[model samples]
Target: MKITSIIIALSFISACRGLNMTRLRPYDLTAELMFIFEDIDQNGIMTVFEFETVFDRYDSNVDGRVTRSVYTTYICKSDPVQYELSHYLFDEYDVDGDHFLDYHDYDNFYNKMDTSADGLVVKTEFVNYWVLLFQKYENSDIHPMSTLCR
Candidate 1:
C-alpha cells in the first residue's frame, strides 16, 4: 500500500546519517532551531540524548527543570539580542501556563516532536515538526514564530 511505502521511506531517511541543513529547500527555520538545540553532536540528528542536553543546560537551577528565567536566557543567548527578547521566547515555551518551563512542559515539547508516539523522535519526526511549523508561519502574517525561529 502507499502507506507502507511512505513508512519505509521515512524509516530510510531517519536512518541516514547527518543533516545538511543549508540544503533543505524553502529554508526550514524550525529545523534550524532544533539543529541548534537537539543536535548536540552536530550530526544532523535529534536524539533523546541531544534533546536532554539542551534542556539540561537551560535548567539552570539544577532541578531538572527549566524556569522562565533560564529559558529566556538561553533564547536571548542564541537569538539576536533584543529588548525583552528572552521574555517573548520564554512566553512561547511556557506550556503549562504556570509562568515557567518545567519538566512537564519539556515533556510536552518532546511529546509533540514524537509524532509516532514511540517516546522517541527520529530525524524524520523532528524535520516534519519543523516543516509543519514553517507552513504555519507561511500561512499567517504574524511573525511570532518567525522571531523564535530566527
Candidate 2:
C-alpha cells in the first residue's frame, strides 16, 4: 500500500509537470499527498485531533519527540516521494537546532498554519501552504525540491 501511494504520487507529479509545460493549470501533487498522508479522517480537512494523532504516531516510543530517523521512517511508510523530499523540509521542523521535532517544533508549525491564530487549521489554510510552496518552486532554482517541481 505504501509503495502504491508513492507510485501514485510520482505519477501525479509527472502528470502535473506535463500539463504545466503545456501552459495548462496543472494539478498540485504536494497538496494531494498532504491530504493522503495527513488528513487522517479523510474528511477533506485536517483537524487538530487528526494532527495530534499523526504527531503521536511519528513520536516513536511515545517520547513526545520525533527524531529525523523516526520522521523519515514515517514518511517512507506514508509516501516514498515525501521521503525523498524530506531533506528539503527537515530543517523546517527541527526547531531549536536540536535536530529533532518536539512539541515546541510542532507548535511552531501549527502556528504558521493557524493564520487567524484561532488554534485550528482548516482545509484551506493547510492546502494553501503546499500551493504557495509549489508556486515558490517556480521562481527559485537553489533548492533540490525546486528542481523536481520543474
lDDT agreement of model 2 with the native: 0.65
CA lDDT of each prediction against the hidden true structure = 0.60, 0.65
Which candidate number would show the highest lDDT if scored against the true structure? 2
How many angstroms is residue 150 displaced in model 2 relative to the true structure, after the best TM-score fit? 25
Evaluate candidate 2 by giving its C-alpha RMSD to the native, one decimal: 10.0
Model 1, span 67-138: residue lDDT tens: 665566566576433213345445555787887677667677778888888877777777787677444433
lDDT of 2 by residue, 38-79 (tens): 877777666667777878888879988888777777766765
RMSD of each: 14.1, 10.0
Worst 10 residues of 2 by lDDT: 18-27
Reference-based TM-score, model 1: 0.57
Q: Which stretches of candidate 1 lie over 4 Å from their true place?
A: 1-25, 29-33, 41-47, 81-89, 135-150
Q: Which candidate is the best by TM-score?
A: 2
- Residue 15 lDDT, candidate 1, scale 0-100: 41
Candidate 2 residue pairs in clash (backbone atoms < 3 Å) = none
Error of 2 at 23 (Å): 17
